[model samples]
Target: MKLTPIGPAALVLALSAATLSACGGGGGGGGAGGTDAPADYVDGATFTLGLSSDPGNLDPLMGAGSALFAVTQFAYDPLVSVDGKTGEIGSQLATDWTVDDTTVSLTLADDITCADGADLTATDVADSLNFVADPENQSPFLGTFLPVGAKAKGDDATGTVTLTLASPSPFVLNGLGSLPIVCPSGMDDRSSLAKATSGTGPYELTEAAPGDHYTYTLREGYTWGPGGAGTDQKGLPAQVVVKVVENETTAANLLLSGGLNAAQIAGPDGDRLEKSGLSAAETTGLVGEQWYNHADGRVTSDPDVRMALTQALDLSELADVVTSGRGGPATTLAVNEPVACPGDSVSGALPAHDPDAAASLLDAAGWQEGGDGVRTKDGQRLEVTFLYQNNLGSSGDAAAELAVQQWKAIGVDATAKSQNETTLTGTIFGAGDWDVAWVSLNVGSPDQLVPFLSGPAAPDGTNFSAIDDDDYQAGVDQAMGMTGTDSCDTWLDAEALLVQKADIVPFANNTVRTFAKDAEFETPGQLVPLSIRMVAK
Candidate 1:
């Protein structure tokens, strides 16, 4: 598949880190009449999902969670959309889009209407995007895409709308496809999203009680749907209900007991689930991670020491604990999943890990093995501290901790610091103060990784390891300038360079899989879920 240079965020940010503590406390009461068949025309049956955390927000812009996106498949509509099955661009709200030598114009669907019953148009799209892009709003994700004041004016000639870009941004299609249209009603640049539910997608949000459950029903008489509704043997669920049940073990148990339709089981449990009368489907998980923070200064800056450090840890052990051997070992930030950096697969001059070679390099760099067998240079001990967060959710801490064991076996003094949410988020990530911290970032797509690992991204600029390389930066910039197949090749080359330099360590390409019993819209393995593929059973 041809990947876009500018991809979606790594999917990890959308992961469920907290549970529905309050819940308005809905009873996991069995559905009335317990019929296997749903009582709706589209969805065969209303399915109940056990999510790892509560819905972060109903606001589309601030919302996080793979399940939230699953529900939003109904509420909002983007100008361009991808095919869930093939990652191909299919029409939804936009009937067609045209690109000039520099400018791009999008044609909106005539059938477009919001849940508030407002007719969606180009004006709404422009207004909503501007709201998120405004400096005052301070949207966390705004920096990932077009910069502030990026989306310029749009003109409506008769019935069609044309949009102009600030510059020749090749990622325009990527930006437009993900930016959704919002209603102008009760909206301002600094308005609070108390009950902001105005979108033009498959389903309308009936109700959402934060820290509780979310209920969404199909939009009646909806004509604009993605792909065919369903196959002869398959049907879309009439309704999609998501409730937060944080315990991974509980998620697995409920799935086995048949009380829950499908649940995302992590690590060892996933293995048990696959073997226990359950089917498996995975998306390329967005969680990109690495060990970093030499700024605190314990000599992680030494190239040979850093290389040796990376070589010491065994990924197979990490994978065994984190994914239960379900996914492959991650070697670079951008794995070969949809939305991966086009540069991730590019050709490079980096060498793969060789323990013997690592030891040789360390020795050559003056790391003389001491009495304790620990390499020491200038009387400094070869050691580092690793930090991570995911107290409530799966952070693969077990794997990271076991990696501590592996490094120790390799004669390296490494300690794993599994932190509490406040400490991890506040001290490590928030303060940028640490020795070597381990963290995972899931951007719905690999393109999302460009900003996280790429240097000097707008606003917050997260190139956490502070790996500032001119050649590597140029490669990423070149990829950003590309739109089609060449973009992929450029990104692949950049990825190779990153691997060679050991800028970031890859652990595993998240399979993006979640277990579901109902199979409402049983899509093949994918990273981002397109609103178009959702069917009404």
Candidate 2:
């Protein structure tokens, strides 16, 4: 699974940081419009939700980012659905499932159908999983969600799909909950899904006007929603319009004006939105995470440099600034609520703010501060390039500026650069041109993070930063042996190893609020289709 860029909507690779932002929060009805009680549910109304950026690709397998993940949820159905509140597994495409160590078997629902009115079979589901599992396909999900070397076989007559894993996966079922199953038609002609959608979901993409909006029309007779829910409910929306409004204030304005049914406001505008008494679906997620490029020739490759850079900044202050004082100290990389492993792996594990210690670490590493204050080592100036997501709004920009100043004060010439979700994903995962970045890869399961943290460095694999921590790897190996929450202790220990070594920095976690105007819905990383209910203005 590709790392979701952090944006207005939380991304889980299972959703990406960008896509996960919209996916956070548990099930909830829309808050009343300035009253004590929520508005009455209405039938056949249009629901418009604002997106911070346009989800460029509609292909379920090929795309990477929050927008694509959010939009795809409209047209794709995963094998199962995870309850946002209880962390319970619920059925969607698959009616029942059984897992034993490395093997997983699922019984498909007979009535499932694709948007094109084609009958969805067990074969189509297997093909979609196989397509992503095949390394040659270079799917971002190759090792993350679907275990590496996983193979699936389908028996249509029995309506069953059996998967054999290369190794024991602890949260295999949870991973499957986020893996969108592509229909046979989209699988055959993958290019057709670039702007169109073909999947066994309740909504189908009917209009695509990129950068402005993408419209999805509801499918009648759609009964196979999460938890075996149906679309025949009284308040279900007839249409869902995902409007691309990058500005948080603009989105808030539109929500207040009833032009949008929901919009995630993470900036100062959230204050007024709360005051307006608009209903909101909220979930806490890692909003401020920092990563270093540990590849050869990078200044951050040196452990001492990485430590010093981390020590240079006051993380508490940075977290507050980045979140506009709305967030708290990050306790774990898995901040998505109802997380598979719930614990505080980050609190006391990281190096604290100590500028003098930072300077000494740099000095010990042979980077001496010159008369100009910028450090120099072996005739090379210690200049650093930093990148962060632009969707974080002005607060994010301020945080980046503050970090640069803090680094400069410690004799490191650091320049902060902001990039949008799409460009940043390409830079970090494809080009590998960045030195450091503020990106968060949100997922419910700890196992989903393995491929990105340890495996081959990108272009080759999703380990974009090229982290090679033996302790982390060892713990992962140990944790993978255990099943479910039985492995939480080991997983938290492994996460601490990464933090203790300064491999990754998860500083702040915020309650990501997706405010609703005339509709109420659940976003367990992405909007739950069946949870959406149109309401009176």
lDDT of all the models against the reference?
0.52, 0.80
TM-score of structure candidate 2: 0.94
lDDT per residue for candidate 1 within 1-537, as digits (tens), equals: 111001112122344211111000121222211224333323245656665545344566643223444444456666776543345666667677777746666666665667667777677777777766665664434534443345544444433555555545545565455555666663543243434366666566677776557776666545544432211222344555676775667777887776666565555666677776565445554243454553435567676777776676665555555655556555445442334343344123334546777788788988878788676889888777776544223536667677677666556777667653223433443434455655555432344455455554223334445566677778766866667555766766776677666666655555544665534233322222221122232
Each candidate: RMSD to true structure? 7.2, 3.7
Candidate whose lDDT is highest: 2
Candidate 1's TM-score reads: 0.75
In model 2, where is the ten-residue run with the lowest total lDDT? Answer: 18-27
Error of 2 at 535 (Å): 1.1
lDDT of 2 by residue, 423-528 (tens): 6777777846788898877777788788778978877877878999999999999998887899999999999999998999989887777787756666777767
At residue 272, give the lDDT of candidate 1. 70
